[model samples]
Target: MMLDRSITNTLWQLQDANSRQVLALVQKFELPEIVARILVTRGINVENASDFLYPLIKSLLPDPFSLLDMDKAVDRIILAITNNEKIAIFGDYDVDGATSAALIHRYLKEIGINSTIYIPDRIDEGYGLNTAALLKLKKQEVGLCISVDCGTIAYQPIDDAKSFGLDIIVVDHHISMESLPNAVAVINPNRFDENFPYNNLAAVGVSFLLIVAFNKILREKGFFISKKEPNLFDLLDLVALGTVCDVMQITGLNRALVSQGLKVMSARKNVGLRILFDNLRILEKPSVAHLGFSIGPCINAGGRVGEASLGARLLSTCNEEEAYQIALKLINFNNARKVLENEALSEALLQVEQSVTLNTKFIMVSGNWHQGIIGIIASRLKEQSHLPTIVISLNNGIGKASCRSVPGIDIGAAVLSAKFMDLIIEGGGHSMAAGFSIKDHKIRDLHDFFAERFADFVKEKMIKVDGIITVKSVNLSLWNQLRRLEPFGVGHPEPRFIIQGVRIINPEIIGTNHIKCLITDGNTTARAIAFRSVNTKLSSAIMQSGVKTILGRISVNYWNGREFVQFVIEDLMT
Candidate 1:
């Protein structure tokens, strides 16, 4: 039977789980009923439940050489290290790219090699390898250039680097075409010719594998016989930061990487990361949420509004003073980015309110927006409207756009298709996100193309509930039991449960948009918060004085020295 829609204009569906399987999970693993149900719904059976709940790197880490051209890339990097060649790392301008570059650079530095880290300007250089940047590196006498987090599709630039007497190795994780770029080595799991078991790694994850292979070969060749080898484990903090920030699926190897990486982050081993944490006033133990929301955005702020290379420099630096200065600068840049983001988001929301209609299938808004901030604007709009959104920033007659897509939609493929049809000047991305350039005159055509492409897509938003519970059941014990499913992201999501027959008490606005209130079942009350719900129907329903059912994830909120269970509201039933 179909359930009625919630106040958010979407149906709330309870996830289905087999009763027999749930019982087996509970009996075999000694798990709680709700946790077992969650595991069952995620297709976790007795055979794989152990591995899923307790993912270890030793068990999940694949042979680094399993990726195609891994040996070739390792050999080239070893040659560069042995011959004392000047190496330059060209990376993208996001958190993933910065961490990839920093990871490789730190590994190289530990091996007594100093390499230049180059992050292309988002506005000036756009993304990936450019001919001018390669020529500039060549002029600086850089013999080997490793392009991290990008360069999978830079056919012309890689070829140009070859002609210019600079050998380039591409360490990336973006989807590849049937034909490959002419780099010295193209090490990517997603290569069509490759048979890598796990291909959904972020670019930083790919870079880590490259270093692993490189380290293995060096050890076999007795290169580290006298000198101490770099401890690769120390680098997991960067891996975790990149993996979470890139929004990679936290399963299998990624789950292990982040699980271990959080431990490393807590130790404050990385000087830059430690200073960043201190400057940001993050006193609590680090979690995936802290990495993705707090640290990642600050690192990304440099690429968006300030110097593109600041994040890489901060991550790679060892000098305490340098790290401190860079951390402060990134924080300031992030603050500035927030101001710009708020302004752009406000403008975009106004456009949506004025122009968007119920028939609108795709939302595309263009303005004199900051080029670096459009991606964030698109993300905010997508969350609000539940539609694939494209936010474009206009400069002269050219338009630079960033796209964010909903589930079941392939925005990247759509952008690529648009590019193939000459609707865009240049574009490519993964399924959920993409970017492209187009002429201002073709804006209407691009909109029409996306509209037609997504015409059959359902516009209604849905929230899947794990199970139903009462307000009395919201407690620390339940939250701790749910902690077994930690490090949630794309594949493994934080569980959302429905709390029935709740009434709001002491509802007040907190922060800018969040509502802080106490939800009660007339007997027991629990603290609840609805984040970014202001001005929405959800907020309206949350403030009303009536019996209501709410869906939210349970979490622990610490204030001062007291810890209390907090319900994070997602949707409300009225």
Candidate 2:
């Protein structure tokens, strides 16, 4: 029983002309042919296939005046909101910088244009354009500054806010660094010339298409109201919870911006996102995995454990009892960011189980960890050891990092190889995520510069297995036709199914360290479980196997209650 079903060259397969054009458009939209072969192996081709097989609110969105410098970023923020000046907006405290800085500070105060936002405090000024808070918004003479979900890597605070004159713009979506940050207008769709046809938006859907191109340039300059187009779909539930808590990739116009931003977050209509969806009791209909593991970790737990301007003042508060006391102080700062992300992910998993010869293939641990929660413990060890990590946080000597990658590893090119070996005074991010700054003995030169950059970027790269399905296509009508592919974040995922043979019946050891088997051999009967599979000796050697055997599984279950499946027995033979 030396199980290792092999699959993991950073898992990613499926492209036989995008899986037979996603099984002939899920048999021409009759769907459920295993959710049309996982939505044509997640490319959703065939002319955008009925918008991911039917994610309506009218498809083919785009026209926030067709993107490219979004009409010069909405004609220079409506000429700094009709010259009364002082605008601001900044943002970035997670959940797509607190819903794109609370939807451009409530659409510049619903056109009366007062706007003032800011945000930046991921543990007091981290993540994005700082210059001592742009020199206190250029000593509050601000004038213009837009940003939202971060300025495409500021480039020295947009060159010190244009040498303290101001008029920046930015509205980002991340990937883009060839040198484009003297910001005067940069609404990114990962801008590289911005064809704007769509390349995965969600910095609150590019700041709600720069507030629908600044309300169509304040409706052809009639200035504010003639009363008509201002319903930016009621701020698309804060741009679908910051595009599914900044993971984006739900697909094209971010799946119509998180399916109409989860129906304007289930009609709770602002009031501090309905008191943060009533303190996460979640008064129903929010999904995209509850806007990424529950309201994007309670709005990134006030920028990782309190006061990153309390999730941009509970997403620009107005009332409802001061958004229920900042939604109970952002749910007690997300229970203190889950006890500071599980005490630095249980001491970085006990220093990755007592440093097994510094497990190479890219990993750069550090100690005293908490650079505002070591990027959620390098995203739970790049989702449990898929690889490319980086979780620093020294003290007296500085350090401070936070990475997390796996899919074909590129944690911002392994922290830009410690900023090309200058010992990283600041690195960047992209492929899978990044962030840096260093010098506490630059941890073995950032663990030998990510082991010579994952010996040519993540070993040889191959094990991604997006295939293997059957087991009567895990029914419930293929989970309600994979719920019409309703909102599956970061490049549309959900659809795995692996099941091969079956035979467990009476396994046991339920919760408090799970097991719960129940599969049957007679053609296939289900009910499997694994979650920490009862302290592993391969769960009592597959419950003391006597005869029957053959296994592999992946279509997991338990939507909100949490009984995951996608059969993770990985591999076993008897």
Candidate 3:
């Protein structure tokens, strides 16, 4: 039996279960028991084992019409396409929003429609649709407007758009409130009244579904009888980028979408993405990590500190010359974002250290930090402290704050509640992350409320280990087994395994705060790395210990067409 672990000292427990079902699955599917165990852990039974491992788009993709108001959304787009009406696409500043808008814009352009793209400024306009923006679209005579990755909560602005005789379609995946905005059609799986099976789709995934519905309608009307129909599968590259960047759960439909999308991305079909890949000098095929860490951050930098329109423009533009120029600009923007993030992060860390007596379960740091870097600072601090963190940049009398949270906490719901209660001027976000603006006077009250809400759950910190394996088993075969479960994030996380009684050799500090070491279990030796742990207990334990156990994930490194297995250490026990 397992008991709840203490908050101070981390507990390491083996993840074991009855093996009858796993063994049965291994025999039936002719798979290794190690792979079967992982599949079972993710709730994959005999009926869906193979499908889960190798998900196909045709098998996993749901009917687009199942989502509420999907038909209505498709009808409006068809009307615009047939009548040659001017349409505008409004997207958020993040990667999900940029890719969502790009997916639709590209499809429309393929069918001889030219749509205007709008991305709201993060600092000036904040998130979602504003009344002023809608009025400006009306001035431009845009008959229809589609808001992606945002506008689900902008009731007033959607109402204003209606008054201006502009039809609006909302293709978003954020969790909706009791009532939705007055848009012409809102196609969201997470809506209060909807019953769609897949609710954790990123905004770009929802946007892709809208296009699927749009294409089906056009085909029925013989819109593609003369011209070759656009292959919708080609758009998966954007969908995969948006889904991974937004940190959507990779399961069911999402798994198929991303698996297929990565193939499309590796083909270098998108000129802008190809330029980014070439700039990075990545020789291997694109993986989930490449999208999440490398490509996503660079694309998001365009929205964070550089021009807000750069990301959407880069993704949608078909002109090779324009794509190359925008890609280089985005790379420069990413470098700038890093500098600003480090400066603000140092200040935020100091603030955290000074507030030891605060009675809150969350970390709240307020400073003269750059607004563009606060969100990244919040995310880094949250990871370091294993607690929900909010970084606020004070400008004039009001504070703009970005929040990041751990599992089991709904920071976005808390921020939204504060907004509803008038404690915050404005704010909205998802469960794991959020943003808000608050007056200086209400800071104390916000702290008190957070303490009361989160204190009871603060003691639940335990590091979960999937299974223990011999170091000798960490070879090419094990790597292949792990690769079967691709595209891990959020809900379906990457599995971490434990290797027992390993001896470390030649441990040394590497880049920044990372430590690199060679480990051996008497039979096999492998390279392992621990990130951002230069001076931590793991560093000392690895160097001084006689024998130790380490927790990590396995990855394959390819160089000059040769492949080898590598261990990425996440935690250690002496």
Across residues 426-526, which tens digit of lDDT does each residue of candidate 2 receive? 76766777787788876786687677767765443323234555545544555555666767667666544434455677777765667777665567666
Q: Score candidate 1 by lDDT.
A: 0.90
Predictions in order: lDDT: 0.90, 0.69, 0.85
Candidate 2 segments exceeding 4 Å error: 1-32, 36-51, 54-76, 79-81, 84-125, 128-131, 136-142, 150-202, 220-245, 248-253, 257-377, 380-382, 385-392, 397-494, 499-574
- Which candidate ranks first by lDDT, i.e. highest? 1
TM-scores for the candidates: 0.97, 0.34, 0.95
Please give, for residues 1-574, the per-residue lDDT of candidate 3 as tens digits. 2323322256666566558879878889888888788777778888888777788998888999999999899888888877888999999999999999999999988887899999999878888899999899999999999999988788999999999898899988876777899998999887889999998899999999998988898899998899889999999999999999987778888988998999999888888888888786677889998999889998899889999999999889888889889889999999999889878877888888888543447898898877778888998888777789888889888899999898888887888777777888878777888888899888888888877778876644566667888888778888877777777876677777889889998888877788888889987899877777766666777778588777888887776788788788877766
lDDT of 1 by residue, 375-414 (tens): 8999899988899999999999999999999988988779
Q: Could you give the C-alpha RMSD of every candidate to the true structure, in order shown? A: 1.5, 19.9, 2.2
- Between candidates 1 and 3, the one scoring higher on lDDT is 1
Stretches of model 1 off by over 4 angstroms after superposition: none
- Candidate 2 vs 3: which has more lDDT: 3
